[model samples]
Target: MRLRVALLTVLLCAATVNAQTWTEDGDAAALLPGQTTVGSGPLTAINGTLTSGTDADLYAIYIDDPQNFSARTCGGTSIDSCLYLFDENGFGVSMSEDGCGAQSWLTSQFVAAPGLYYLTMTAWDFDPLNAGGLEIWNDAPWGVERAPDGPGAPGPLAGWGGSAGGSGGYVIALTGATYAEYGPPPPTGACCFEDGQCQVRTATGCNSLGGNYLGDDTTCTPNPCPPPLAGACCFSTGGCLELTQPMCNANGGAYQGANVPCWPSPCVEQPPGGGWSDNFDSYPQGTVLYNVGGWTGWDDNPDAAGVVDGSNYRSAPHSIAVKGAGDAIHPFTGIQGGKWVIKAWQYIPSNLSATTYFIVNSYYQHGGPYFWTVELHFNPALGVVFDSLRDPNATSALPIVYDEWVEIRVEVDFDAGWLGTVWQYYGGQLLYTGNWIQGAVGQLAIGNIDLFAPHPETVFYDDLSLQPWEPPTPPGAARPLFAGVLYGGLPTRTTDLSGFPNTNWLSGFPFEVDGAAARPDGAVFISNGGFSGKLYLAPVEGPAIWLCNLQYPAEGLAYGRGRLFGFCNFASPLGIYEINPSNGSMTLAMSTGDRRFFALDYNPVDGLLYGYTEYGSPTGLYAINIDTMQMTFIAPPIPTANSAARAMACGYNKVYLVPVYGNEGYDMYVYDLAQGVGGVWVPMTHPFPESQSTGGAAFAPGHVPGDTNCDGAVTFDDIDPFVLALGGQAAFNAELPDCYWRNADCNLDGSVTFDDIDPFVALLGQ
Candidate 1:
């Protein structure tokens, strides 16, 4: 059989006394998690001084019951009772006990210096081994009373009607609680009791059994409780209340009466109203109070008393006020101008010279276009001066005036220097220009002026304008001329071999053989046939051969008016080829070569082509009609052993020759085509003896008429040489051609004379 342990109910009582007493309630039954209810009540005393105490104590007065339980198991699974005490000094204490079934009494004490305190009790299973019930009561000097009184008390002993069938129940009561001086404790294990109070144990372990129990009584007194001082309020065991003026609490301690006295607190006092003045009455940064509502203003008003419209002004106590004079009397003898714009409307006067002139002028000391004034002025009649301190001095005069309502236009041309203009105007009309009564008018003043006409002047002004002048323009830009190189010596060769007789010409299978003639039209022509060649015109100084192809020549060659006549030799037929000078393109002019043609030349005089045959008793020079392909013997060729003239050149109204061979050595001869006669073959007067052999020659195109040497200039050097050569007094020598007799052939007509001097001069440098 399982042993059964019955629940036990114990009724233990504590005997410790405290100076103050408080009661509390434990937690309500069936409360949810995180929910709590607090018990509250007023503390009433019985035969004890509740007014004063340095400490407080708490007690738990409650009932407990434990139902049937097994012999080995105690009914300790319900909530336990706990008590806590808190003081106004931020101190707290706590005590706990199992229900009346276990340790029935719980108490906590704390030091609380003559002030309000609070106590609390809670019921919970704080320890896993304890589960019981609780009921709380106020343990004051009065007997223990149930919370909420009588049957309504919250506990198992309150209005109970049940059978005790092996279930435990106990009723705990608190009594004999009072405040008094603590007495010496009885010996340990001593029991004591009082009316309606059960036996309780003292702090010394002495139990109170059936006697007047003084264990709950402790020392409590009024203890000099006073009121709070200034800047503090009275907060008592009741609640907090504010301290006001006159009702001062000078004792600076706690008080128990209503409306505890206090003084007007500095903590709640309003800040003082402040103002400042520049006069020595108040230095800068110094302040004073007016005790009035907020208002602050700076006054600089003068005696004239001008009103500033649309401005609201007020003065604040302790705020700074800077004062200056507004208008002043002028010392000089000129018209007085008033202050245009009033900076401030109120002012205080300094103790200084009152009669001193406070003249107003339109010049501001501060650098700006706004208007200001001065105390001195200049007069066109009596010069400038200032007023005396006490009396109007003889030097006192009216100040100069300016138009304030208009744009004061001042024009300054830096280029014009002093000649620039300075003008003032009222509206659009000009008021003053070049008429300034000049003097130093020092201080700006705006106020009343006691003059011959005593009256105050008020003026308004703004927006003065200035115009800056510019300088003149400087000169312009410049340009240059276009120029190019006209003519010069070019290298050429007519041979087929390389590196022989100079590499002026390139060698190939098919070779073009022709003489290039430069035309006055700024072009050149080349022939491309063996003997029956094609003529191609090319641009002057352009590439002689472009891409190894003749630009002009699917056609044949030609020579006629300002052109070369092309004809075939014994190997090929002749066709007239007109060459385009710009790109070397060739066109067929005419073709006729059954009559064998050998050489060609152009008559410089008539601009006609001369052709020659290879075989004849005397090779004849014939003029060809380029239009008709007809020919006439213009001149007989040279008497030569060979049959044909190999080369010919025409210039100077004559034709020159080169023979295949002659005993006279590369002989040169000229024939006058006009005379149609054979002349003596004249050797050219060459400048270099090494170059005397007659290779080939042609007259330069566009030759200046008197520049014989082709140097483009005529001079005495050409004249003297022709005079000597015309006299025939010297021999024709190639080494000294300039002095040779052949040089007289200046016209190159196979003779020399003064008539040749002209053409000699024409070809002098050439």
Candidate 2:
């Protein structure tokens, strides 16, 4: 493989304007008095080339001013130039590799006593120190006396050898030096563009095209242009992207002010809302419906457009007709909570050739990472419509209804107690009812709805509606500060930090809870950590229902971005996984790689996923990339005698790690990510809640105390709401239905009462 190298040249401002050019004349001599001269005049540009791979160009230049000696190779063609500076006795003084983008430069190495010097350039991997029949680098720097013999350093001959077969031309720019010979300076060389593309062009032509001219003869083989700087660009919809400032600005994202990576992201949260209903009647007949009214084709392909047909209409004179590869999708955001019903009237003709799809994504990140919540395949040939993602084997027994308008209704309940559930019905008859298939169980959000046709199977859709339904919250199911599985056969428990050192357990769970996460509506999902890894929905009063089974035992569970993330061990390639909140199915979001993560959580404030990997080089907390699974070390490791994996959860700007097996019973550790990276996990200073070992920590959404209005902060504005909450739960719920009434318990005494009045006042003052 030919290594193409580029270089950077540094020229010191000189007084005398002497432009001396020395071209290689019949293989310049390797010793003293070879070809070029380095005097105290101006800059000397050396034009050299390697005729073949075995060629070596040695410029025997004389340096008058020893202190101001600088030799650099920049403009090159098909060459990875390696520059070496040697003393008069042929002892290597200094060598540079890729000093400036693939080129070499020697500026820091000063020549103590400048008499005669050999400035040699060669392709990479051709080591001068080893080719001299001796390990010169091992003898104290690259200082070994060796004289050049010819193009290929023959056996036992002290000269440049091992020419890794590279034929290229290069221009060496020298400053504070002069050469004896003079020739026409080469004008055309490699020009680099901003996109890191190189093209051979003249200095004037290159500058005209806004490209950096790498002198006269630089190769465009290997890209040497420095890459553009990128930083975290945060979006209002809780999305963080790493992009250049220009790109970020173009996309209307707030740049994080520097080249900051997305991990430990500097992004701050904004507001959120997304959902839409559309009827094709508004569009003109035969119009391409793709990219119209937020409805775009799959992957934004304009060719896969749905035509608004006026012939097949269910309620009006228009409906979107999809055929061939036509796939239409309408996206939604922040639709993960409560129960949602998606209704659309579809007409599939009897002449359908292949299958069609009605899909719903739980989480569809702007660019990708689509988690399928519902994928109902309608196979006209098979005369069946089935839920592919959830119950693929069980095709709905109901016969396919064709040639008529049929209402396709899918009811999805993400906040259905613990596990998100979905119900599909076609033409008023039940088709499928099961857990919503998604990455994680905690987040119950739907990203978008897709209508697709695989193979010219014409399908018509009209009058689509995606709306939310209010599901009754189970009694006694209120927000809790802490929820985890107690060790030593103790049931799962819920507690509040408001009472602090004397806080009592709010409720004892019905079953074994190893890992747990809470939905925004205060429903908690707990898991049993064993070989079976059974997961359940822990209701406030009723018995917990078994949801699904996990492949591996999970100690920590987290809820964010409408999904539940788990730290699953007891399996090879142990790492973080997305636990389907509806079915408990697991999808490997990211492998731990080399480290082992014990806990995981999602920070809403920064819109970043966090995990803890103990006992490794990067043994500490990390911000994980959900797409790439790359781990960025953020905080130091949690120091403990027993490094057992535990459950983790996030609240506001804080991350709480639970069931830390310390000298005392299990303790909780809290780390404030707002404190920035390198933050330490400090033991909770307050008194302990549950005295047993626990795992799978969880915090109810918006669980801050004294924030009766649930505005995320305790201020005087909350006084009215706090007074209402103190009056009665029913009255408070009627007024502030969106706010968590438990937040009025400012005293952390686990209840809103007269005792919370003073603490509320204190919080207001603060």
Among these predicted structures, which one has the highest TM-score?
2
lDDT of 2 by residue, 162-249 (tens): 5475767888887645443223343678887654457776675577457888887677767656776766666423334555676566
Which numbered prediction scores highest in lDDT against the true structure? 2
Q: What is the C-alpha RMSD of each candidate to the true structure, in Å?
A: 55.9, 19.7
Error of 1 at 444 (Å): 99
Give the runs in model 2 whose Cα sits over 4 Å from its true position.
1-246, 249-275, 438-442, 471-642, 645-655, 658-766
Residue 517 CA displacement from its true place in model 1, Å: 2.1
For every model shown, what is its TM-score relative to the native structure?
Answer: 0.23, 0.42
Error of 1 at 207 (Å): 99
lDDT of 1 by residue, 451-477 (tens): 111222223211111112222111000
